[model samples]
Target: MLAACGSADDSAEQPQNQDGETEQQTADQGGKADQEATFPVTETDAVGNEITLEKQPEKIVSMVPSNTEILFAVGAGKAVVAGSDFDDYPEEAQKLEKIGGQEFNVEKIVGLQPDVVFAHESALGVGEEGLQQLRDAGLTVFVVKNATDFDETYGTIQQIGKLTGYSAEAEEIVSGMQDKVDEIKEKAEAVTDKKKVFVETSPAPDIYTPGSGTFMQQFLDIIHGENVAADQQGWVMMDPEEIVNRNPDVIMVMYDYIDTAVEDVYSREGFDAVTAIKEKAVIQVDENITSRTGPRLAEGLEAVAKAVYPEIFGEAEQDEEDQAA
Candidate 1:
């Protein structure tokens, strides 16, 4: 599972055009006023809550990493005043004020006086009461859904864009993401030999893997790789014996923050008998790219494709030759 963290800093500087006006400047000058003209906008959130916005929000707080990424990607970075402890993407998010982690700091958040706050559906498990407190304070709070696939992620971007007055930018971002996914799918269709892959989210002793209906499974399908755990559902803890029995062609480790090593997987007593271990095909993937449902997901897809089929999707031979020179 992705860990919840916080952030601390300031809003990003807006990009300026030839007219010496930044996007934020334009929004402040007239864009927000125009948005307000269409206000009293009503929308349903992921957790089935109806949210009505009477005016454009100038101050925003994002309580989840994915929401923070969406907010920044859709040109609302300047509006974000605080983010969860786990939001560390885009460099800009790192500068926002930290508002606690999976358990939010309700007092601090209320003190910030944000016009809008973004939360995740998953947060309901632990932060629902705090969210209600925000609502009780007469603040507008929106809950983003927990995206299991790329389509839902795109929908999340669209929803956030509409709320933040960046609908056009959100649509453009979605189009770009769709184009990249289509390109990947086209490449995947050309592969004649599919490899069975095992994805490990946690290290041994108690190992965890994503099965059917998870993003990792979808990613494997996109790259023409078979998930060894496809028979299972959701995140399941598998016995080492089960992994040995499956004997995947490739093993992808998804934890980078821990001290776990690829060598550890290769050296496991019974694992050496597996094809992946015997051939030294154990690969490490960035947890954020593979796990976070955000703007950089396409980059994550490209990385997975390359990891699974280096010969086909890896760096060009010409580039390698140039580097050797």
Candidate 2:
């Protein structure tokens, strides 16, 4: 996903200073050009709009949970004065004033007077008008895309850092994430027999799974596990019959807002005959970590890796004991 912050309006009304010149006139007289040189940062957002920032934003608002997490991770948490309703990470984010979710509160955002607002590409579907209103109101809006893999996630982190003056911290965070992923990949290479896994993003009757060309598929490949839905593309609804026929060795249930459980998957009709159900290999994973494209994505990868290959990654405590002995 791409992100960009817009420059302030040059035509906005301004009062005259002690120098007998209006603020806009002063800006046009070279002050604005000089400011742009000091903050010569420009980025292309998800919709391919080139956004330029004239200064570091002090008051910020995040309309996407992933962006909110990235903002906090890069040490720009203090700049975020407002967040979306779903932003709950870093604990402190929950304390921020909630502007709105997919349907943004344009008036609330305008009242907050944030220097910039982080949004998601999905907002284009329904919130585009609201976003346009924000832009029209002279608010800098950065729209992030729906990242399909770790690379896009990293790009988003870097973009957010650049916009928030936390580029160095973002690079450090990205490097650490890369190192952790490399370690996991190296360890996964030792597995001679990779497990075939099925990831359920939603509950039964209306089951949904991440297919090929998605972050979940990439994650499965990184850990040397086979995604049963790899043949299908993108997030698709799967029939229970198809899932049962696949007979996955591991079933990962990814949901938390509902009352769905591993037992629920195990007890589903026909599911009982599946290898995962019979062996009790149905695992419930944190949807936020596994799904949200942000700094905690490494944690999601590790969680999936451990879940699929417990024999390799789950022996940490036992290995330490053996070493001590």
Candidate 3:
């Protein structure tokens, strides 16, 4: 597993001003010339637009929950002066000023005078006019790609690390996550009997499973489980009768639903073909972790591993929780 090492501290490399506040590097050159010295942001946005900032922004506003988590994980949380409405993870993040939902409030964000704004693909589309207004007012806007798989997610982290001037920290974090994933894969190789799982994404007890090409599928693969609804793309709304026919070995419900004592399988009348329901192997997972591809994604992976093979990964999951606590 990737060991979390505290070998190099990046606190020193973070620039500080005379007043003890972090300062953004000036855009020395104009236009494309300035892009060279700026934070090394690579990769195109969802709209296929290349985004490059002039420097590490001192004041940042995060307009996506996932992006907010990434910013905090990269040791740039202090730089985030504002956040979107749904950014409630990581207790410290809740303390930031709210800038509306993924459909961000451009006026509120503009009022904050952030040096830069980090937005998700959806956010830009939903609030393009507002975002453009901010850009016209001289604020740098960077829209990162929404990765749909593991490799792309890892690249997103590295890309963010490059943008924030924390390349080493980003590399170490991703490497550590990679190691944990490797360990899970290695251990799961010994299990000849892999569980087939159906993951439900809604609170209404609907049969929804992530498609074969999605991140959730990659997450399940790391845990040595096969998604029964792998034929579809993204989150597909499947019928309960289809789920009964599939009869997966395990069912994953939203963690919130666990407390509510709800079951998508059990709710379907006269449908008990699913082995998971018979064996009570249904597990609940945090929706935010599974839903978003961000810095703490390793936690979500660990969650899946624990839910799938509690025997092998129980101790590791406990250790991760202890460390987080």
Candidate 4:
């Protein structure tokens, strides 16, 4: 919203006399040149297109929840005129003009006339046509790749910041996340006894868990916990018998939208012999924070680290209400 405010200050400074007026005029012209030199950004997006923004985007629309979260964290929240239906973080984002989820509303988005539209690569299969429609309507559309790790996520934030004219704020957010991750890594070095961990994404008869090629596995590596599902690849459904045979010392429940998650894990048939069950180490982690790959991911990593080994990483920093729920 304040993207166009930089030029106003120069115009606001009034001169007391003719000599001062000439000096002020020169300073104003210099400032204008500097501003002109900085803008008209042309950069390669996740897709190969060279998207250019002629000036700082005063009105922006984000097509993904993680992108919306980035926009808010980088001080560009006020510029966000609209977002996808799934964008619920930052509270205020819910109040924005909501485009359809999974499938974007091309007409509505084009009608909003956002200076730029932030789309993600992950949505291509479902939204490619909608994106092309927006482009046909002469809208600025940039596709952001879905990040699989912390480093890539940081790069995405920096990219969004640069395009939105919030580069400095984005750097600060990225730096803080890096510092927290480093601290976790450093503290994890103190672990002499690592525990075997199992993370279940969906529970009951159809149990799904992340394995070797996913971000959840990367998080497990950071916290120095052994993933029982490491032998499998990317989000596989493990048989109940197989999970029992693995006998993980810590079981992490990874869904928050459903109730009875912890209880369902505890009461599963033949799970009584499991080490995690016997020791009562079943923990519930918020999927939004842990899986979003946004600004709060490092905090999610810390929370999981703490839950796995409280003695080394301190207590899990869970909200009382969330835990109770």
TM-score to native of every candidate shown: 0.86, 0.84, 0.80, 0.86
Candidate 1 wrongly placed segments (more than 4 Å): 1-40, 315-325
Compared to the true structure, candidate 4 yields what TM-score?
Answer: 0.86
Model 1 scores a C-alpha lDDT of: 0.76
Clash pairs detected, candidate 3: 38-54
lDDT of 2 by residue, 1-325 (tens): 1122221100001223345554334323422222332365799999988888878777899887788878777667777899877787767788999876645678888988998888887556667777888889899888887787888889998898788776765676788788879999998998899899999988889999989988889999998999999999988999999999999999988876667576689789988888898887887776777777888788778888877888887743343344246
- lDDT for each residue of candidate 4 in 28-108, tens digit (9 for 90 to 100): 232222233357788788889999999888789888788887877766677788887777776767888977676567777
Q: Can you give the lDDT of residue 212 in candidate 4?
A: 97
| lDDT values for all models | 0.76, 0.76, 0.66, 0.77
**True-structure RMSD, every candidate:** 5.5, 11.4, 9.4, 10.5
lDDT per residue (tens digit) for residues 58-163 in model 3: 7889877777776666556767899866677566678899877634566777788887777666444446677667778777777767777667778877777677
- Tens digits of per-residue lDDT, candidate 1, 1-325, equal 2323222211122334235655445433544324433566677998898988777677999987878877777677778899988788767788899888866778788889998898877667666777888888888888878888899889988888787777766676787788878998888887899988999988889999989988888899899999999999989999999999999988888777666668789889888789998877888866776677877687678778877777778743333344236
Error of 4 at 86 (Å): 1.7
Q: In candidate 1, how many clashes are counted?
A: 10
